[model samples]
Every structure is written in structure tokens, then in C-alpha cells.
Target: MNLTLRARRIAAIVLLGVAVTVTLLGVLLMIAAGTEDAAIEGHTGRADADVVSVTAGRTLVRFHTPDGGEHLPSVGVLYPDQLEEGQVVRVEYDTRNPDLVRVAGRGATLTILPVVTTLLAVWAVVSALVWWLRKPGPLHLRKLRPRRIAV
Candidate 1:
């Protein structure tokens, strides 16, 4: 096979591999992000997240979840969000520990998975097809031999 063509084939394979790698990394990141302590099971809890105050780093949101029975949550510094005094929004909190809070339906981090897997699957199939198409020409060349000139 020609060196340039072989290099192209190798490059295509490498690109496919990179796509798979990135997809795997995204999956791992999602798993790590969802990790919570045994004491608190993060579950769906209906609560109000008021637009308290948007701060420098994160928007501080406040919401009340099912406490030991109910009542109110202690208003304090919540990281990742600067909250306003009052703004209504939906939120999810840990059932066991109401303190652990996160925005509902924001677990879309794994959404890139389908796109990455699709790209890799397409590349692998196309790579095989292209290599097969180019293979016949080389074989035909091998079949040809030096011929004597009829003088």
C-alpha cells in the first residue's frame, strides 16, 4: 500500500479511538458528580428555589425540603449560587439530608454520549468500507508481471 494512503487509514482509526475515549470520560465524570454520602440519599423533593441573590461564583438558591417532618430550612451561605431574597423555582434535595440541594433535571451532563458513540460507530464502519474498496487495486497490481517485448 502507498505510504500516504496507509497514513490516512491509521489517522482515521485514531480519530475513531479518540471519540470512544471522550465518550468514556464523559460517563466517568457523570458518575463522579452524582456521588453522595451514605447518610443522604439524593432524591426528588418538591421545593421552592427563590431567586435569592446572584453572587460572584454561583447563583445562591434557597428551597425547603421535607425536614424531620417539616418547618423551615436555615437560611445561610449556599455555595455555587448567589441568591436573591425571593424568586420562585423548582429544586431537588436529599431526602435524608435536606441540606444537600441541586437544581432539578440538571443532570444532562451525559447528553453528549449519544453523539460521541454515533460518530465513532460511523467512522469505524466507513473506515472498513474505504479500506476494502482500495484493497482490490493493490491486488490487481500484484497480479501483473514484466512482459517481454516482441521485436
Candidate 2:
């Protein structure tokens, strides 16, 4: 095999492995995003929910949004260690649905994980194809001519 082909094969394998790892992480993050979405969609009667439980700065409670759905949400205000339980804090929820809620804002952060994983997956597939299609070395050998005798 040509040195180039060999090196490329190794690289392709590494990229494929990285792609799989990234895909797994993406799956986990996607799940987290869905869970967060669900949490905020629960309360519908009021503008915001009251903090029901607080150990420190963090609180757990059900929030009321414009949509009129309900959910039990656990959120950290300043931090779980700093805020008191039952402290009322303004939280954002889904506009279309009321039950979904969050302590801070929408869980848009989780979207990046899947996007990066998808990019890695595409890169891995392309690299594997390139490595597979590569043709190394010459197809045939050239013949050498005979040398003339010296005087």
C-alpha cells in the first residue's frame, strides 16, 4: 500500500470513532432539551409561579404561564445554595404551551450539541468514502534499457 493511503486509512478510522462519540453526546443533550421544554409548559393560570421549595438559592415550584398549563419546576435562582424556598421568581415558559417552564430561559444551549455531532458525522462519512476510493501506486512498471559497454 502507498504511504499516503495508509495514513489516510488511519485518519479515517479516527474520525469515524470521533463521530460515534459525538453522536452519543448529542443524543444525551437532545434528551435534556426535550425534558427542559416539558418542564416549562406546565403552568397556565398566572403570569409566573411561586418557588415552593428552596434549600439554598435554588427553588422548586410550579409556574403559571399565559397558556394555562401546569408543571412542577425545579429551578436555581441565584444558586440553590443562596435563595430561599417559596421565593417568587420570574420565570419564562412556552408561549404556545403553558406547562413547559425554565428557571432562566429557553434551553437553546442543548441545540449546539446535536449540531456539532451532525457535523462530525458528515465529516466522518466523507473521509471514509475518500479513503476507500483512493488508488495507490502505479498500475504498471516501466522497463529499464540495457547499458552499452564502455571503451
Candidate 3:
């Protein structure tokens, strides 16, 4: 079960790389959520968008702004819960940028649960890998018998 020093060092390096990658992904998710929050806060408007399709992960909606232009947010509808295809649901959008839209009463808060869960899962996997990489030596019992004297 013993691991060579070089193997341990390599494991440490790989662990560090994985930690950095996971951290970066979490930060990026938070930043995107914050940006959407800011956009909503800066200028907000409401419209009943036509739901073109709905799925557990995302929803597609088509809505018209007061400026007389139809737009669909490139990222699809935000916080599109309990929605169905062909249903009309009110949404809050960044009037300055109509393409940024979220279902009414939904905001960046929804992003927290998924991101935290993902981080926890990643850490659990990395921790297991680290434990396996730094293996310990097998147990052995010492002899208890006394030695005989030489003639």
C-alpha cells in the first residue's frame, strides 16, 4: 500500500489542478447570475411571453417589448418553473436589453442550490482521490519471543 514520494507529489499536483478548475467554474456561475441580477435591477419591464417549449432544464419563450420588437433571450427563459409549452407567463426583462428575461418572481437566487451541490460533489470526488493516492503501509505485528544466548 505504500506510495512512492514521486507518486504522492504527482497526486498533489493533480489535486491542486482539479481544485482550481472547480473553483473557477463556481466563480463563473456566480458572476453570470450576478450580471443577470444587475441587468434586471438597472431597468425592468414586464410582458407575457409565449412559451414555445419547456423542459426541466430550460424554457424557450417569445415575447414582445414595448419598443415594438420581438426577442428571445439567447440563454432561454430564466427560472422557468411550472411552465408548459404554449402557455403564457409574465416575465421581467431588462428593458435596456430585452433579450435578458426571467419569469416573474424569479431571480438569481435560484442559481445557488445547483452550484453549491455541484461544488460539494466535486470536492467529495477529489477527496476520495487524494485519500487513495496517499496510501499507507500495511500493518504488521512485532515478534515477542526472547533470543537465546550463544555458547
Candidate 4:
């Protein structure tokens, strides 16, 4: 095989690897969200939490338990969309582990869209790149041919 063909093969392999990695991450994300939801369902607690801060990844909240003890989940609340700092919002948490908290009425289902879309986007891009790399082209063939000269 020529250098171009070998290079294309390598690139396709790399893109396939990236797709596999992304798919695995998406699956893991779904599993984690499901697990957290399960934990909250098993031993549920309700509280009105004060949104301390909101970042792209997490929303920090401080809430008081039934016993009047204050708790703030270090990793922040799950499914905390549309919340702003200093806002009060209802939250559900694992009574046994108060640190495990999420926005009330929101569950693992909320994660499905983002994960599925991300996987679809990654696969689409990777498939296109791999196809472009592997597909045979007239231009590519022409480039491999030797130049002709008239004496």
C-alpha cells in the first residue's frame, strides 16, 4: 500500500477509537445518573434549598434537614437547571446520605437527552471522517500515477 492509503487507514482507526471512547462515557453517565436516582428514591428527604452558586457543571445549595441541621452537598445538586444563586428551590435527597441530592421532581430521565445527543453527534462526526478517509477517490488515484514526458 502507498503512504496515503496507510495514513488514511491510521486516521480511520484513530477516529473509531474516539467514537468508542465517547460511547462508553455516555453509557457510564446514564448508569451513574440512574444509580443516584435510585439512592434518592430508597430513602427520600425533602428540603427547601438555597442556591448558593451555579456553574456549568454543578449548582451548590444549602438546606436544612428536618432535624434543623444544615447540609450542603459538596458536589452540588443534580438536575439543577435554571436555578440562580440566592434562589430558593425545593430539593429531594437521600435521607441516609444527605449529600446525595437532586432537584425535586427531576430524575435520571433528564440526563437521557444530553447523553444520547452527545453520542449521536460523536458517532456522526467520526463516521463521516472515517468514510472520507477510507473512500476511494479519482483524485487520489491520479496523484499516485507517475508523470508522463514527451521527448
Q: What lDDT score belongs to each candidate, Candidate 1 first?
A: 0.56, 0.58, 0.83, 0.93
lDDT of 3 by residue, 82-113 (tens): 88999999999999888889998888878888
Query: Model 4: per-residue lDDT, tens digit, 1-151?
Result: 9888898899899999989998998999999999999999999999999999999988999999999899999999999989999999999999999999999999999999999999999999999888788877734455567778888
Off by over 4 Å in 4: 137-151
| TM-score of every prediction relative to native | 0.41, 0.37, 0.78, 0.88
Error of model 3, residue 140, in angstroms: 13
Enumerate residue pairs that collide in model 4. none
Top lDDT model: 4
Q: Which of the two candidates, 1 or 3, achieves a greater TM-score against the reference?
A: 3
Worst 10 residues of 2 by lDDT: 74-83
79-121, model 2: which lDDT tens digit per residue?
A: 2333456676666765654444555544546476657768776
- What's the C-alpha lDDT at position 12 in model 1? 64
C-alpha displacement of 104 in model 1, angstroms? 4.8
Q: Is 2 or 4 the stronger prediction by TM-score?
A: 4
Q: What CA RMSD would you report for each candidate?
A: 9.5, 10.6, 5.8, 5.4
Segments in model 1 whose C-alpha atoms lie over 4 Å from true places: 33-47, 52-60, 63-87, 94-100, 104-151
Q: Candidate 2: where are CA atoms >4 Å away? A: 39-89, 92-151
Candidate 1 is scored at a TM of: 0.41
lDDT of 2 at 100: 47
lDDT of 1 at 34: 49
Tens-digit lDDT string for candidate 1 (82-102): 335576666666675665555
Question: Given candidate 4, what's the lDDT at residue 60?
Answer: 99
